[model samples]
Target: MSCGMFDESRDVIEYHPIPLWITPFFFAGSYMKKRIGKTSIAEHKKTLLPSDEVPNYFSQNNLFARLTYLVFWYLYVMLETPRIILYSLKKKPDLFYGYEVYGARVASIAGRILRKPVVTRFQGTPLKINEQRNWNTLYPHGVLGLKSKADAVIMANDGTHGDAILERLGAPKEKIFFWHNGIDINFVINTQHGEELEKRYDLNKKTVLLSVSKLVLWKRVDRAVWALSALKTDYGVNNAFLFVVGDGTERAYIESLAVKYDVSDSIHFAGAVPHEKLWTYFTLADIFVILQDVGNLSNQVFEALSFGLPIVSLDDGSTTGILKNQYNALLIKKQNIETDVPRALAMLIKNKKMREGLASRAKETFASSVCTWEERMEREQKLLNTLINNEHKTSY
Candidate 1:
């Protein structure tokens, strides 16, 4: 059975194509419904998007920038969504799950009005968002309104995000299920043998330090560059080099910082590589660094773990819960760079055995403890099924 927005040719659900959002949950929902022999529904907003999602216009003088989404995207969704929904309703799907952050509210409303069970996954706290003008209008009160109406809300990570939804948004804590944002362990551990990956990246005799998130200020890609600069200047680490994968609005700014720090020649910007090819980069790296000030359990960190590489990240967001200091990962305190990051990096670089030991533990953890794509789908399914099976037992 196909559910959500399944693209049959890709054999997967089309989630977020652009980086404005993360769509793993959408894929998770589709995979579950497909396995269960049920179909899921993908519903778009009934009205035009609030200015929050797309605050800027094509051109400062363009008249269309001031026009309502109703005149543009809304009309398109209005024309397409109903036909899709009606066709599925006529066939009577076993379950209807709405996925994604912005569109989940509309899906929940449709499910309620249609007398069908609905489940929505909440991945991050309102605090974790970029807080730019466009995002403010797009997700105003977070997804609290829709979550209140939803039968179940699945949280991708744990702690503060769930606390905000329950205490601030009034969502019942019991109705929210926390699923660790996971990676494909097998994909990482069993990637194309190490030698071929090294040759492809030309990583001969170079100690590769990799950062794999979108180049954004909050992510602090500059911090990695600063650390690399310190490595060269303070420790004479001539063999160390850094590879930054993924692109975003901050690309130019990051490049500028690298040049300013005089480490431009030591860094590589490999933009927006597809998922399949990511493992090759992972295999080439000796260490992975994630310096994002917010959010926990980044996808890049997990992919690094699959390759048995030691990970270094700030103990903020979900990072604290997902990783332990000096265990599977090396944890640095937030904003304690003067005291911790340099010390940690220096320690890891100086002690090859310790770094490799952490890598082995990380691999073992990914294989034995971390959830895979299939496990994540089942966990999401259980939450949705529980919501559907006992809809009236709890108040919204």
Candidate 2:
């Protein structure tokens, strides 16, 4: 089971080569499924999870409300556990794989009953905000046991998240594996959406700066707006424009910041473009900026690299391990967001040769390293096969 939103209309499951049986906690329905054509994965009956339609005053800060919310989800998982166990018994799956913390707990329970090895992939720091807040604690008695119970705990990145698992969850070192996210290079290279967007947005002859991610507060999209203002005012980058793709709760706030900075005209908020159609925006970009507070490796960074776009990001765990300063990309110190982000952007905007050099090296790095979706899946498949074959059972 995966916790991520699986909207068939916007997201394409075909990119994932593995033959999956997805049981998403939240799904957009059969109408969208039919539109996307036959998916590579089989869809299971959607889980009856609690909806996020709480009253206005029912806030996360309220202790009673938080506990009630947690209890409701725990009960929901318990209700679904029987179905999971029965399904495992009937299908006899080689292994049980869960995507997030909630799925991990459910799969772990089912795995123990069936005595099958369980693998849980933590897409982000487990028990972090916006998801389960107490996943580290064991359910019912509220003890710490989820990480210890899993046969193997996979992390999407080996940066901040991996460190959190080791230090916070106390996960065994050997039990952890880092599977960096990968991109569809062939799709990125071949897919093309014509100048319809470019013409509509008046992108021609403008130095295009792109940032693609959900418009969330932690993402610090306001920083992009500030940088745009800095570029024009301090750096004399009049022809440059920042295109922010993706939407979230912070849309109005971000727009307000743009107005305050007087870069509203320069910063184009291209709200939530379809995932399949993102290649067009990628093709249209000259440089990519990711102003996330924690610089974990993002899918947008991989997509930008696949298109050979020069990237400007902060020097932190999110980008440090993957991007090298003055090599594939430029990494600014976090303290220097005000001085350095604009400086870096201005430098890239003015220096055509430097931009091409960084972009070229970035593409080369992705091509030579583990950057393709097929390679990522291959590693995961091998790991699953190893666990199923019971080879080096005690090693993990």
Candidate 3:
């Protein structure tokens, strides 16, 4: 069946336009349910299946609790797989389009049983598949084996992820296709929250450095704070202020880092702004900084480019195609991030001409290549249509 495991309503936003019979498995909270209800998917599509609810005891913070949670979750998956297989047999779908890992696993198994093609899309770096290691203990060989069985594997971003799939997971190279993430360019450009955001943060005369992402270790938000501190001490850039937008587990640790660096006053933690309001922060920023070491591309990078903000990022695999050194963005050498990041930030902060040059090129690059959601949707549709048509042909 054409199925997906819904992590959030945002997942629907990407795949919504595809003209296919879709049944989403909602594993989100009540707020996400409300969000999904507002979408056209809720009205047009078949009823969404609710994921098996686990007990509150699973929430306990201990090894036993964690293992118990995994055990229960695996049991739920095992129980659900039969239902999915039965549904697939009844529907005889052209192909299965799996969104997340769990969905992909279910679809892979179902596809194998029914002798149907499975197209799985990896939105982010697949769990435990990165430069650091070839294998993830959490994912295990069985999960990877199931993933490798897919007829086609579509990655949301290019670069390192494709390599990870082929080299690490032993997936066939021909099955891999890279579709760079896109954003609503006009929406970001026309969005007008600059004045209000500036006033809210008292960013009247200060040069604002914006980082919009989840507060996580992989994101290296602490490094961003350290860069800000260096921008002051090393480069003598005191007027520069950082506005961190988004919240996660590392928020407290990041806050402590800011305080430790004595740049707490300069760093404004505008925790978890609404997605719609993100454009304002993007528009108001003097420079966009992403210290993410993992994942090839981010929606924030595209959004920042769309908003015409100059970017300074580490020259890691994630920024491979999207960021060009001294072109669209200033990519610092990852080896010397502690020194190079501050240098890049200082260079952009001090030189308006350079910033404008990079910003102009960045916008031009985005406009020509990854501009809007429509363009991305069209590409995805083409890929999906090809897969479905091929499946039909093979069946006939």
Candidate 2 Cα errors over 4 Å, as ranges: 1-61, 126-148, 163-167, 188-194, 200-202, 391-396
* Candidate 1 per-residue C-alpha lDDT over 1-396 given as tens digits, one digit per residue, 9 for 90 to 100: 112533223334333221222235335443543455222111211221111121221111122222322132233234434644675565544344555444554455456656666566665554433343443244433433334456566666633355444444566776666667766755543265446646655678777888898875555676787788777777777677788998987788778778877988788888898766777778778888876656646676667777888988877656655577888888876657645666677778778999889998888867765777888887765655565566463336
Q: For model 1, give the 10-residue run with minimal summed lDDT.
A: 50-59
lDDT of each: 0.60, 0.65, 0.65
Better of 1 and 2 by TM-score: 2
Ranking by TM-score: 3, 2, 1
Task: Evaluate residue 128 in candidate 3 and report its C-alpha lDDT on the 0 to 100 scale.
Answer: 38
TM-score of model 3 vs. true structure: 0.77
Least accurate 10 contiguous residues by lDDT in model 2: 44-53
Residue 97 displacement in candidate 3 (angstroms): 1.8
- Which residue pairs clash within candidate 3? 296-318
**Model 2 residue 307 lDDT score:** 82
Overlapping backbone residue pairs in candidate 2 total: 3
Q: Model 1: number of clashes?
A: 6
TM-score of each: 0.71, 0.77, 0.77
Off by over 4 Å in 3: 1-77, 126-138, 141-148, 158-163, 186-193, 200-202, 391-396
lDDT of 3 by residue, 95-194 (tens): 6666555556666676677776677777655343432352333334234433545777777773346546544556777777677867765554324466
Ranking by lDDT: 3, 2, 1
**How close to the true structure is residue 97 of candidate 1, measured as C-alpha lDDT?**
51
